[model samples]
Target: MARRLCGEGLGTMLLLAAIVGSGIMAERLAGGNDALALLGNTLPTGAMLAVLILIFAPVSGAHFNPAVSLCLALRGDFPWRLLIPYTAVQIAGAIAGAWIAHLMFELPVLQLSVTARTGSGQWIAEAVATFGLVLTILGASARRPDAVPFLVGLYIAAAYWFTASTSFANPAVTVARMLSDTFAGIRPIDAPAFIAAQLLGALAGLAASRLLFSPDAKPVAG
Candidate 1:
């Protein structure tokens, strides 16, 4: 149990570091080209997600997102008793990772993002982003357990381009990003709506999965 928690924490931390750190680097190097910066950030983030999931899946199911954990718990693929703890650690890990990224870049460790990312369109985008993420994850795991890591990575990479919100499908990631004032940050004031949308998206995804797969659906591989 302790080891599984550790895996969640470490995996989430590394995931956030990859996201925030790469965003900072991309912003610094993009020479004012937002698209190019996003591209640079997206590639490394997706790559790191695949690597981290592959590394930790065997131990803790590699759920670095609260939305994913919640969805799995609802599906009975994850133990209900561990749901809260998993979410707690993932959030803590995300915050820690954000601070670590700031430290690495010699920026202030404590900062609230000012990048106002509100509005209905953004909220809807988050819902669609998270819905697609969970859907892809569950669908791929049911049919091709061996390919979950690559499938999730690919989905996120594509979502980054297609979604208006740049696919912040993870609640933990959304909260942690509020602490970063970088290219990937979202304003702290707008975090709640994003979180709400993500949770709703999770539920929608779970429903869709249930409708499409059997009650004894193939358990999702980490």
Candidate 2:
């Protein structure tokens, strides 16, 4: 159990480090080109996610996102008793990751984001992003266990381009990004709505997957 927690904490920390660090780097290099910055941010984050998942999956299932952990718990794929501890560690690790990125970049170690990410479209996009993410996880694990890492990585890479909110599908990432005040940051005020949307989307995705992938579901006669 301790080992699992370690994996969760370390993986999430590294994941956020990659996200925030790459965002900072991209912003500096993009010279006001938001698209180029986003591209820079997207590739590193997606690549890191796949790599981290592969590294930590054997140790802790590589659940770097609280929303993913919560969804799996609800589906009976994770232990309910450990949920609180897992979430606490993930949040702590995520915040630490943000601070680590700041330190590496020589920015303020603590911050509250001023970037406002809000509104109906943004909320809807978050829901869709998380919904797809959870569904991708569930489906891939069900049908292609070995492909989970790459599938999730690819899905998030695609979601970054497709979603208006840029797919902040993880509550821990949302909170940590709120503290960065960087290119990847979300305003502190906006984090709650994004978290809410992510949770709702996770549940929706779980329900959808349950129905769609039900072993009891019979083939339709053609």
Candidate 3:
């Protein structure tokens, strides 16, 4: 149990560190070109996600996101008892990671984001992005467990460009980013809606996964 919690904390910490650190670095080097900076942020995050999952999945199932943990619990893949502890550590790890990125970049460590990421469209985008992410996880793990790391990594990388909100699919990531006043930051006022959307998406994804991928479901004939 201790090792599992540690793995979750450490993995989430590294994930946020990579996200915020890359955003800072990308923004500084891109000379105000949003697209270029976004690309810079996208690749490293995706790569680090794959690496982290591969390393930590064996230890704690590598669920760095509260939404993922919750969904897995609902699916009976994770214990209901450990959910709270996992979530607590994940959030703490995310905050620590953000602060670490700030220290590395020499920025204010306790700043709240001023970037406005609001509106119905943005919320819808977040919902869709998270839905796809959760779906990918559930669906892929059903048959191709070995492919989960690569699949998630590639999906996120693509979603970064395609989604308006850049796919802040993880609640921990969203909360942590709200404290950062960087390229990847989202306003604190906007965080609640995003989180709500992500949760809804996660539930929907779980439902879809059950309906489509359940063992009782009939296999399609070629």
What TM-score would every model get versus the actual structure?
0.96, 0.97, 0.98
lDDT of each: 0.93, 0.94, 0.94
Of candidate 2, the 10-residue stretch with the lowest lDDT total is 212-221
Candidate 3 local distance difference test against the native: 0.94
For every candidate in turn, the CA RMSD to the true structure comes to: 3.3, 1.4, 0.8
In model 1, which residue pairs have backbone atoms overlapping below 3 Å?
none
lDDT winner between candidates 2 and 3: 3
Q: Against the hidden true structure, what lDDT does model 2 obtain?
A: 0.94
lDDT of 1 at 40: 93
> Model 1 RMSD to the real structure?
3.3
Candidate 2: tens digits of C-alpha lDDT, residues 120-196: 99999999999999999998887788999999999999999999999989999999999999999999999999999
Candidate order by TM-score, decreasing, is: 3, 2, 1
In candidate 3, what are the lDDT values of residues 136-185, reduced to their tens digit?
99999987999999999999999998988899999999999999999989
Q: Where does candidate 1 stray beyond 4 Å?
A: 215-222
TM-score of 1: 0.96
Backbone clashes under 3 angstroms, per model: 0, 0, 0
In angstroms, the error of model 3 at 133 is: 1.0
